[model samples]
Target: MTEYGRQPVERQLPTEEARDLIALVRELADREIRPHTAEEEAAGHFPRPLFTLLSESGLLGLPYPEEFGGGEQPYEVYLQVLEELAAARLTVGLGVSVHTLACHALANFGTKEQRAEHLPAMLGGGLLGAYCLSEPASGSDAASLRTRAERDGDTWTVNGTKAWITHGGVADFYTLIARTGADGPRGITAFLVPGDAAGLSAAAPERKMGMNGSPTAQLHFDGVRISDDRRLGDEGQGFTVALSALDAGRLGIAACAIGVAQAALDEALAYTAERRQFGRPISDFQGLRFMLADMATQIEAGRALYLEAARRRDNGLAYSKQAAMAKLFCTDAAMRITTDAVQLLGGYGYTVDFPVERLMREAKVLQIVEGTNQIQRMVIGRHLVGPESR
Candidate 1:
């Protein structure tokens, strides 16, 4: 009686609950996100209202526990919502994904008291959250980060700068990674730092090549103070928490990648249908058709990769390698698909008039953020080498 009827199930569509949620999310995207995307980008304004809508509609809490007003959906279902959002607007998709990432430590490892105190505002608000891990010098090598967290009786004084923070200046809270001891990853600790902390200040927003509306900036932690209760886990466990959070975050980026690719492909298809050349439509041209075919192929494959990774995560399997694979392949596929979509548009693609150029710019960041593609390969390489190799 379901849509899969008689045909071999390639992948199961969403359950009734998930399908209903998707319908709601899609309607929101069509009405709110898509309409103002261009205007928001042009004016450098983020869609705070859309985020409020998502919170009000219960989309922001999709993968969290329902006791805290979350939807308690599986990652597989939650990611589909992300993909749909990304297709309409990368900024919105990325913002929601980053908010999810920011909430990861609290959701996964926070004390019961911490979850009770923070998860409500984090999941139920118009306030966006940010994950602060990257520093100017310690991007790929997060373990080597130098931000200091010195113990002061019952409180910790955090000092140093956090760079390349998404939602840097605007986030309501930051899940910050700071060093609590001497050298390497084991010494780092995670803290739920309030954005308005007295000494926590942000530099001017970074002038980015894309996702400009999302607001990346450098944050200065000048003797910021927090109670020991704010520490996410045991002292010296921040790096572990950060890495674990990224495994999930990678899937979010992968979904974003596929969304960007799908958007590019859709744009190409529509343009080719309307764009005339050689006495007919460009869609009719064999060469262009082949290019479009290749683009579609990459997107399909990327989608499969990300969904598989999501499934693995949902099943509680060791999915770090698969996640890295999905992030690497999907972001790479997005770069290619978006680039080709531009080519399919010819000269118009290079300009801001069309969205493919923005998609292309957005695709590059997926490769760098969450975990760099180079780092992803390193993870995969270690997996191939086996644990005994160490």
Candidate 2:
């Protein structure tokens, strides 16, 4: 259960069905997910079995159409469920979001035949997915990507190095973007590639300061071949598809950020009350009490902001700007709250004995992934003043 579990969130759910859905998710999360988070993360393990359980429980495809084996929940409900999962374990919550992003292209733009053949299994059949957009040199400057996909009548041979890919070696499939023509965004094309395809391999995962439970690595595609039938959307339109998926994905990151902050707050509150200081509980101190209040307030504010953005998305409105804002603010808040939790605990927070130390390390990555916080500001600025012609 999340900090949302500690104190119930008064949600504006559209139906009783949604309310019951969230309750069940929380019960399962508390009973099954949180128990292993600390032990598994410390061992730097990826819990593939946990993801299989999530898929089996119908949690993997919550925000998509029910016709494709999804639950068809709206963004608000999906995101809240994400918050609970992240509060239980960040690896699982973010993994689900990436899976949803990986499925976006075919579900939204694939031909009817493609959907019927693949969407059901991809969404709920325990298959994991990876979205490949950021390369070693083309993360923020995405239009300048150098991966090439040469088409030959019936097949496309892909060659490139994709960097910073989560679920890199382990994912069942990849949603790949590679340059097909020209030199800019217009030339990029999206393709679905099988994980076991020849000439495709993942490098050793990057050794990171945190989030050890999730693997991140560089992928190499050396003339990996796929049928033209695997192409998603139209040639030269991959950038559009990527951007659309990211707009929704940013909301997921925002929700996950709030979940981390809420967890950190919960930890701090629990520790302060039970922790003895100067012959009494540390909660008796004025200074520590103020810190707790501020942490709680930041979490509430982040949750509200992200939910507002989610509502805009569920209404089918333009929400890229709001999504960017939420991602930036919520991630930054998570960093602050987690760090504060460590500080409030004094030396114990700095050691592996406390979960706050791990939470602090994990919070650092949210600012960097899905697009850096700097990129979020650029997106928001462009929306406010219109993009400058280049």
Clashes of 1: 0
Predicted structure 2: lDDT = 0.90
User: What TM-scores do the predictions have?
Assistant: 0.95, 0.96
Those runs of model 2 whose alpha carbons end farther than 4 Å from true positions after fitting are 1-10
Residues forming the 10-long window of minimal summed lDDT in candidate 2: 1-10
Clashing pairs in 1: none
Per-residue alpha-carbon lDDT of candidate 2 for residues 74-115, written as tens digits (9 for 90 to 100): 899999999989988999889998998899998888888888
TM-score, model 2 to reference: 0.96
Look at candidate 1 and tell me the lDDT of residue 242: 97
Give residue 385's lDDT in candidate 2 (0 to 100).
94
lDDT of 1 at 167: 89
